[model samples]
Target: MVAPLSAWPWEHLGIFKYILYGPLAAKAWYSWMYEDNILKDLWCIHILLICTLRGLIHQLWSSYNNMFFLTRNRWIKQQGVDFKQIDDEWDWDNFIILQAMLASMASLIFPSLNTLPLWNLKGFIASLLLHVTISEPLYYWAHRFFHKPYLFNHYHSLHHSSPVPHPFTAGHATPLEHLVLCTVIGIPITGSILMGYGSTAMIYGHVLVFDFFRCLGHSNAEVVPHEVFNKLPLLRYFIYTPTYHSLHHTEMETNFCLFMPLFDALGSTLNTKSLELHKKITSNSGKNGRVPDFVFLAHVVDIMSAMHTPFALRSFASTPFCMRMFLLPFWPLTFIIMLVMWGWSKTFLFSFYNLRGRLHQTWVVPRFGFQYFLPFATKGINKHIEEAILRADRLGVKVISLAALNKNEALNGGGTLFVNKHPELKVRVVHGNTLTAAVILNEFSKDVKEVFLTGATSKLGRATALYLCRKRVRVLMLTSSTERFQKILKETPVDCQNYLVQVTKYQAAQNCKTWIVGKWITPWEQSWAPSGTHFHQFVVPPILPIRRDCTYGDLAAMRLPPDVEGLGSCEYTMERGVVHACHAGGVVHQLEGWSHHEVGAIDVDRIDLVWEAALKHGLKPVSSVNN
Candidate 1:
């Protein structure tokens, strides 16, 4: 019969006591015996207190004070730890620092046997040296192995999950991987002790040195002096400078050596060459490889894959059983007759006209003209067109009919080549024959807000403005020419003057209250009208400062309060940064090959002002719907 598990005294008296506990206890007892004879009562008491209470008490007190102060203080920002800073305070968020703290605690709690038959000061120092030499090489090789794709995905990917590395990301890896590294330090020290190093000094030296180096390597500050490191002969080989370890964090694959440079030199994985290559590649996108034709095609494939695929077409002869059973009685003959008529119409007349249109309409001059045409005919302009649609989406605008003028503004002439080529851009080619500016404006000006005018603006800009103002639609005119603005103003109605704003020319800023410019506002002295206020925000948010200037008259006329919210709930403030236009040629790539009346930039604020005026006059934002 077997004894009950809990009631078994023999199991409790396991081999652990004889094998592990007895050796450790006997070492401690022997050390205590030497202490009792060599030292008096007070000296023994001091040794006991220093070994047991000093380090633990200090760590505990500091932890409590830091926690208490951080929680209670509202204005005190989190001062993140830096490696270079000797007084760099550690927070619980620093996982590496926490691990080091734990190692320190373990070292303190388990006192080393000071004097033993096998132990000596020389042996203890050697054990400490061996621990660093052995443990660091092991870590370097293991880390390099983890960077291999398969191992990276399983073990090291977690460490790099944070795109912006913070103190918290350090030591954040799989538990199994973490345990493997932690165990390595212990193995080296234990082996040294077995090889006759004094256990007490070996254990204490290992913990203190390991923790110090570990914390220093993980520090954020540039504490390791560059001048000193460059001057140091072979010291850099033994000590991991701050920059050496930082390069590891920045570029993961190559800089695997930690605390020693031997592994890096041996494996030829040192990253100085890789970093220089990275800089060159980033500076010039084409430096690494040629921009392949398939790159854009790959993007298109990604977009298509994200969307659901349509089912394959069914064969003509294989009608489903349900279709045959349900429709055979009366609808079969009816369906066949209708299908034949549709096919006949499509084949004879409709297809002929479609082919004719394709031949005449599908060739147009490129948007930037012939000399500097966008290289990739399909994708270069296409991507910008999609981005334009996205820009419209952000401002709650809708795109409707796009009209392009024929060659020499002739009626019943060939369709505009530009509109015909990219039919997917949604433009309607119009023959601008005998139709007056008023007539064209009266027809399409009802619902359109923005007009992207490409060709010579004979009556296009003025007509669009008149029509939109009559219907209370905001107008944004895009033009490369300034003369077009003068011609439009001459023909525009007196009432329409308030509706149209020219963004390009210098004088237009004085005439139009709401002025826009393609160039950076601050570059030209005249561009800053003493009237309008400037509003600026970061190209990227949060940390970057924003700057803009406005005239007192402009602010007063615009009726904005002195203090207003600029961006993301921040106070409307200005900094001393220059406002430059992003002068990329593909600025409005997506809207190319479209007419002026079809596109415009809408300042939603100006639209709101227009809506307010309409409201004051007791009319809704949409006039036709309200009526």
Candidate 2:
């Protein structure tokens, strides 16, 4: 049996966790719907609003801190928050629920708490005074109490687990520790009520201010301007910076004050370097960050996929991509955000990791997948892609890879448009299709003598066909254009020419058990495939599993080497630490220190060479998906 102090009972609630707050929400709704005195019963509504605002504040901080390009140099902690930290802080909102429940019960026990004036100057003064004199000192000593060897081992260690804190990390604590915190928060609040000075505005203001400070302290980004302390030197003891709070987590024994360093000073436990480090970090904030050696230029697929961004929802991005009902409520908000980004945003650094001591970052073009099909959006999309390329080149990036539709041949001629426009550019522009082809071709077993191919005329298609023909495997090239098909057939040696045959319709592939799809196939088109056929796809927004009897493969992807470091988010629809082959291709280029631009048509001869280079550098192909 688990010890009583080891875990919280409600910790296993998972998605049903929201049910705890349903009573308060339902009360607010019922009062608005049926009660004549809705205003009199609004204390519950106020509580709900405050809870929502607290959640909003935490989310905003999480989003802003993850925008590394803006806060890279200003972050207090240099290390990134990995998947473990993300998981640990996932339930940070638990404290909010407990606090709400306690406040509701208090209102019932004390009739005066049910209805109150909106504002009172005396109440505000009372709250401020009680917070400074009672809450602060009580919290300081209570915090130190939990730090005792026995208490910390069983309780306080949970909060300390996230050494590189995010906004949510502020509320990550054991239930026992939170009870002490509830007391610490409730003392000031309850004291004001006893003195008849409690008012709605005072309550809201106190909690909002409390939440603001807590989120700021754990945001990891150094946002407090150093000039404030410089202008008022004595104020250093009154306020705590993110850097100050960070020291508490790292050093453990010092900087125990809550929001103010005054208590820490009184206790003689303040970190000595807090002020100095805050000043140094703030002084040079936004001036510089580590330059990436490689960049993977990608774009959003759709509104749903947009929320899967690392900065959008940390919990969502930490796992494999799947549409969940929870994301439905966010659609309207995400739609508005999409409109804003369409006109305002540019290529942005999404996430980064290190491999063999070299830095690699994923930069998004801010355009959605559907928008790529819009004729009018073509120029704008290309403009963003070009800007990212030039920016990488200016930053001395060694290799910039284009992912998915970002390298559409018609829009930028497989990245040749940028390469030719900037002839003097030193950064290598890579479409990475060579490795994409190799990944697809290698999926087949040697016994498979023939395979049906769709999108037979596309860049990846042509390379796959020629490579397979070279292996003497008969390839049923599906296409309407005899001219394009003959051109690819001509590229193969005369003896192997017969292996590459042109067929105009999907019906031709009915007999083939191995189908390589380079183009999207509708359910009707997919019906042509015989049962038990395995579909290997390089298609974007991979085809649906319309035929249940047939196995389907996810888009071609490769797993990062075991030694890869600091990877915290998944690539779109790809599993964590696994990326599209094009992405891995550029990684290999950077590791090999190659100088040529991998643009336009792929070199069939280089497919094997690139594949070998990727394995040599420890990048392994993700095992084929069968579903």
Candidate 3:
């Protein structure tokens, strides 16, 4: 009779021990004999060595090969990745230490799992095949189970946190989830041992192969050569590329297999976004060379208001019963935390396209109601501004301007918080208040001798009022507090004082030809002005609705003349003649290519500079008399 199949040479001897062991053993012996006594502790030394080597390889792959991988087979047409939020969550050094400790503990508990001198080629191949087949199904179900509402919020959410996954982030899961994954990975090795097909070389080799694929799946960069899939189409069915796994992270609905797309295709759970994104990135589009010109950050007031809703009805309706119960009692705390987190996080709104001048693109980031109230919640507002600046840096935007109350709130050091926290960012933060003052002042012409100005106590309001007074135009200032009005009067120039008229009531300036509403004045109060009056609104969330008879205009930045090279649309109506001065200030800096322009105080000197810049770009006031 023929010998048992297990007695074959190929099944009993492997390359790792028979061929490569001499050099590895010699090095270990030398270290223990002379280099370091610590090497005598074989288990400790081996674990530390393996962890260090793995870390170095991971770092090198992540830093150097990432771009090469992406460019070779890109899935997205983006220039940079936003990993700032992920960095905040995971500390790499701590993670490395923890991983090393865990490996050491595992080796101590199951010493038989340690790498040995046994070599079995047949066993290695069989064990690897078993591991792949068994683990694929086990991982698929476990991954899908984690997506269920009950476990997702508590555990799996951590792994899904990084939308743009990096290689190191593959293992950034919660303790419970990590344990479950480790158990799944061990099933094939255990099975091979029970079937008398396991060897030390096979087990260790399986771990190495498994980790290699795990890192590749989360690399966020596609390295599969285009020719491979084209010439050998069958390989695509067997191998899941980085692009395939990235879709699972982004879409979060499909592509649940660990190693191959077999299970996903079999279950009809594969996502098409991966293929679509790949096609788009590889297509010969005209926008291949274009880059972002500017980035803006703005907040959504409605979303902030919705967060404080009682019972979290929106959140509860979206989750399963288990998560709903888990989230019930913490409603009040959740609301408060949401309120507090507003100052710490930023939400990217959209990108601005077709802007005027050489600068043709811009990005808008919303701070979620940070601009609603001014000066009252100063600390929280400043924190939000700082976060936006850092986010801009992450997006590779070199210059960022605060809009509306953001400019006013951070007027203290001209965004010192951003500058201090992110000194290495190479980004400039501007309040853009100077251009705002300029655009509003430009509204007043020689035809108007007198004007009504509300919100004079505010920074922009006060600056606009003083600018009008300096122009020798009569100014009627309306404010809530008489004491503050008197205090401002003391700082007014003697000649300007002649033009300044203090009034506590809206009716006091009804007869004025022009009215500048620079604060949150109500519709009723705005209606109190004369029927044919011209209203120049400089406040955010403009209090007055557009009227048919009355001409309502906003302070705006002027666009470059059509004759200028690379001129894009100003994205504002020419009927208004100008855009918000704050916006114009940003445009001016973009034109001048200055990366560190600050318009904090909006002093007369800064205002003159912006006014000159606006004129150079062909920006001027519209005819207010016609209104």
Candidate 4:
């Protein structure tokens, strides 16, 4: 059980907790319809409006800061926000929700706020003074107070749990802490109103600015320019930088001021290295770009997937991709993006992380999956992939893995074209299929005698058939072409040739319990398998689960090593901290420090070798995604 001090009263409600505010929203809507002057209902409405606006501000800052591409070099914490931190700060806006209730109650108790003028210049000026003299010092002292043992253990530690603070982390606090924060924040607005001059504009402006600064400070990236601080050296004393507050989290003993560094200086608690480190970080921003040890070359699946990128909408990207009612409105925008990027696009960095000590980043090809099918788009896609390879080679990237459609044999011969075109290229271009085949073939235990196969002539399928034949495990290769079957059969040893049986139709495997689907199979096609058949796939856009009795495995993926840091976004539909096997394959290549390019045909001999390397480096098979 959670301690009373750490748990909120509504913690058990989960996402359903929003139902608490449903009545208030309905009341506001009802009042708007009936009331002639809606200003009378502004208090009720403002609560919802401020909550929505504040959430958006926090989200925008988070999206920018957490998108590894934008803040790669400037990250305050050189680590990915893990599942632990994400869950801890999941409901970061609970403070605002509680404040909505408190503010509504305060309005009922005091009627003067409802009748205030549209704009009060005196109140605006007073709000500034009140925040400077009152909110700042009070928050500073209260923040300092929480750092002491007892309160720190219970309340403040919740906020501090996220060492690398995202903007949402600004509000990830215990109820007691938020209550104190609400008081500190409310002081200026309440003070200005009681001074008999507070107005509508003053209330909105002060609160929004407070939220803006808070979000900006915890952005986890140095967005404030060093040039600005250099120009006005004294401005550093008045306004705090993200780096300044970051030290407070890392160092934990100094820079206690809320929005200003003035109190930290007066309190004699400013970190000595704060300004120097801030300058070093901000001055070097974009001077020389980050070079990764490994690069995962990826592409968007469709227009909908374009909106699901890390930088697009962070909260959305954090979860598994699926259709949401909220995303319906953004379809037109993403469609426009697909059109605009189709012709004039180049590969760009998407996300990054550090594993052990190696830097790994994902770079995206601008082409969507459908476009790769278009004859016109194949050349353009290959061009982008080539440009990315050249960039990686120039940056001394040790290994670059081609993912999904980006490495399709038809488009660029599984990246062999690029490797051949640039023969002197130092970077090892990997299609990662050797490990992919290992992951698929390993799915069948030693007890399994035979298995059904689809798309048997494809590279991964061919490699699987050859590997299994060596083990004397019969492979019912599904292919109509005698030439392709004989070619693959010849590759296997003379003794194992009988184990590779060529079948032209799905009905050949009616008694087979293991169905290794390497091609798209519809409901009618899937019906050929017996009830207990498990589908192990290497197919893109994994086939749908149609039969209730038969189970479906996730796409080939590996849980990244526990030591892997800063992997924030889920790769496609894989879970957090889990990556596609191909991605893990490239990481293994780099870890093993292999010099050769892993492209074109799958290397059947190295299947077990790569799997062992992956296992050695702590990458575990995530064959069952339910795990």
Candidate 5:
């Protein structure tokens, strides 16, 4: 059965139009009463005031609707919307203001344009028709020209920066491009005036209508009901909708019509995606699926960090030159190596249905054998992580978390090489190490005056050791090198060194009441720990086996509120009985809907915030660790 077609609410339309045009109409009426010849002074202060008011009102309306209305409306789903893109739109508002000022100056310079009479019904109809006929084809061609490679990169690309468009976005173009657009739009009105078939009222009315429809086209919210098109199918060819213009922004090569769909149909440039989306948005079937609030990319170390293996050696057989030179001989070996690695590494979707009723997904890219200890191998591993990140991005992941060794490789700049190399991905990358450090420190008891710390030279280890020293806790720093330990002491505060004891031997750490393992050490080295000491393991792919005597803890996990639907079982060993601080940090940001890099040297305050969020989510310490 066909649904009954309904007419668009006249009152709603009237209210919307009047909000924009009321101020312009009042100014025009006041000017008409004072001036005997309105068109004689085209640069009149009243007209300039009206243009400024129109621009200001248009901006205000767009902001209010996009922020308050369109974002919440299910029909205008916010899945593809990028906040960075919205920020760019706000930046473009300055260009729009400049365009308005230039428009007023153009009026002052051109006295010949002031030829239109104040009131003439025949002139009004002729001017309106001429504008529709002339501007449509000109705008279509000008838009297509701007899409050419050079122009697009320089000018028109700003307009197409966002996948989702809002009303104010209509004016979000480069100044030169805006001028070109204005000139094209003015052609028909100027022609009508030269032919003596234009009126001042008609010119102003046409501009009001043009601005109104342009805003509507970029609103991203469909205001026109589908039933109207269903009832009168021919009207679809006559008018262009917001969905139609969105395709031009998305697909970037089609639908170049200004205010009419006639040119688009005739030129065969109409996009079918727009029509399909319009139908889907207006029907019941489109409303069922859920859109993820946040997405993340995570990379885990494939091989143990101690191995210090070069990635080129690990992937030597797969290199292009090796494959070409050896052909069949290398092919079989490469296949075997790839099969083994594929079994070792994997990408898993970590879906979180949290306490606040938010659904988020994190793409965990576990690197099986990409680990390397040398500086040169860091780039190879980064490249491997980059490929995984790009793959996640293709699946619509919005952010990425560099976990464990991934964070170590990306420290200082937070995967900047990947970001700089792949600007097209637009995914936010963060090192989850900050919160991981916080969770580890939180495990230390207040009564413990002395602590044994390993991996003292590592970034996280250094940061944690410094923090512990600052709190007046006696720290016995254990590392493999005496030179590195001396360097660390020299970098530490004068008073901090007094409380810190540097040692190259595991036996020196035996007297310490608390043990924190920050680096990978052999299980045989674990024999030096005192019988009753608390053991905290921070290293991923944990080095020490779980013991019966000591309280062993890793990172904390974000506990799901039992009632949420579609909850998945915990996967990571660190998250099996307890969550890792790094994993918890990613989950916290995902639940709160923030995208940022948390890499490099982490501060104590950020750690506190993440730990607090973990506590709020019901995360608790897992007493047992995997061997």
Candidate 6:
């Protein structure tokens, strides 16, 4: 029963579907726009806006989340999860050829059949089937050629590396191979459309089906229902089965069918050997199917604790050989913490590892009874800290404990080097070998104003205050415990003036929220906390350099302070809590867009965080900045 090409059923069905739905969608769009009362229109717009905004926010959030997971070493193939048997995967290049052929065909047919005055429904469907048939044989032969020695390594071998199919590995292919495969898909449909028989709907459906089938074959999920296949026995002759595709991924050669199962049988490639190979690969699935949350959490905790410690702060001073071992675990954890912290703070938080002073395996041995005492001492120290914070807050004084800042100063003939680079800016470098009450007072009391301290320490906090009596700055120390504060302050430094104020660590933790409260600071305003007092800000400036096309307006969006009037000095060094050094005159006056002058070759060294010593005491980036 040869039907006329002018009246194919599927083509008529498609036209009907478009005709039926198109007006309904159009009417809905217009009714919301013009026929609406103000309230109705506003409500509809609000709903659409909320949906769109939520999607955008979610997309950004996922990017950060993925980064954190990647950094935390969490993405490593866990023992129980992420099973890859290196045998059951198909080369993605095969799929690329398949998609290219389909895409190419789509490109051709849509323009020709839809536009021509002599367009017929039957011609559109025939053209589509012809595209499908032609691409299959074409891909089969091209795929076989990829196995040849001269071509395989540079061209086809990359896809064969992944023996197991995973969603993430779907698009992995050589660029040249992808182009060749895609061209086959594109040419026929384009040729069809040029012959004045274009149909956009048919092309879209063709691409959609091809992509859907490709994804289905590689998904590694057991989703296809057997009942559907059973009811239609004839389907077995045409559609490629999961088992069929799985076998292709396992074998180095054969099974070149693209859309249909008929080619493998006709080409004499389908056999018991390929089936056995795929089955053998699939048999390696051991019991575990899911990754435990606690494992991930434990790794994260280990990394965060290691990074937050003073040892990681001194990586640069450590030997490269030793530093790598110390830093390996921390890198992933630090990455995850940065991601989590970025979301929590809505600000950038960069984590650097200190490889110097990292504990070696030998340190764990029971030498000088130190290894046995280490945990006891750490627990005892933490307990004492907890007591100090609790005691002080109960009475009324603030307590702050300062730790040693020296990256490397040998203890017991072994010195810990500073592994990470120390910031060149105004970092308060303490000279004391060990932090004690007397050491802190001697070093910082002369200029000390408002002290923002965390943790619990009565001896250190009170002694420093007594020493700072000459300088009248408010003391605001925060800790989780209050009882510990009382015990420490009981032995207060003599002549300590301006009584120490007590605040909860809870309040301190939440301080960032209220810190920006009160009236917004105008350009004319002066510091409200105190003059000449050092404040610790948890803020980190943008680490990645901005695009040269970035202007003062972009800086403002990042919440950076504005430039001084004419000189264009961007004197604002971003900090977490406090605003400090700002750029002075001419700092911001770089040839305005000197960055865009070289479109492709960016001068990476030209970027600088411009801070002014005399003015706003903050820093901003300059395009062609001089350090």
TM-score of each: 0.31, 0.95, 0.46, 0.95, 0.44, 0.35
lDDT by residue (545-579, candidate 3, tens digit) is 65666787754545434433322112222222233
Error of 6 at 456 (Å): 5.9
Q: Rank the candidates by TM-score, best first.
A: 2, 4, 3, 5, 6, 1
Give me candidate 5's TM-score against the actual structure.
Answer: 0.44
Stretches > 4 Å off in candidate 4: 1-6, 34-37, 313-315, 337-344, 624-627
Please identify model 5 stretches exceeding 4 Å from their true place: 1-293, 299-357, 369-380, 388-398, 410-416, 419-427, 482-493, 546-549, 555-565, 574-578, 590-596, 616-627
TM-score of model 4 (CA atoms): 0.95
Highest lDDT against the true fold, candidate = 2
lDDT by residue (546-617, candidate 1, tens digit) is 224442110000111112111010001211110011100011111222233212212222333333332333
How would you order the candidates by lDDT, starting with the best? Answer: 2, 4, 5, 3, 1, 6
Residues 360-441 of candidate 5 have per-residue lDDT tens digits of 5555554443544566666656656777677657646555666666656433255656666766765566666666677678
For model 5, the local distance difference test gives 0.60
Q: Give the better candidate number (1 or 3) by TM-score.
A: 3
How do the residues 288-407 of candidate 4 rate in per-residue lDDT, one tens digit apiece? Answer: 555689999998987777788777876667777877888889899888877887665867778788888888988988888888889977787788899989988998899999998888
The deviation in Å at residue 613 for candidate 2 is 2.5
Q: Candidate 1, 396: how far from true, in Å?
A: 38
- Cα deviation at 550, candidate 1, in Å, is 44
Residue lDDT tens for model 2, 144-213: 9889998888888989998687899988988777888888777777888789888888888888888889
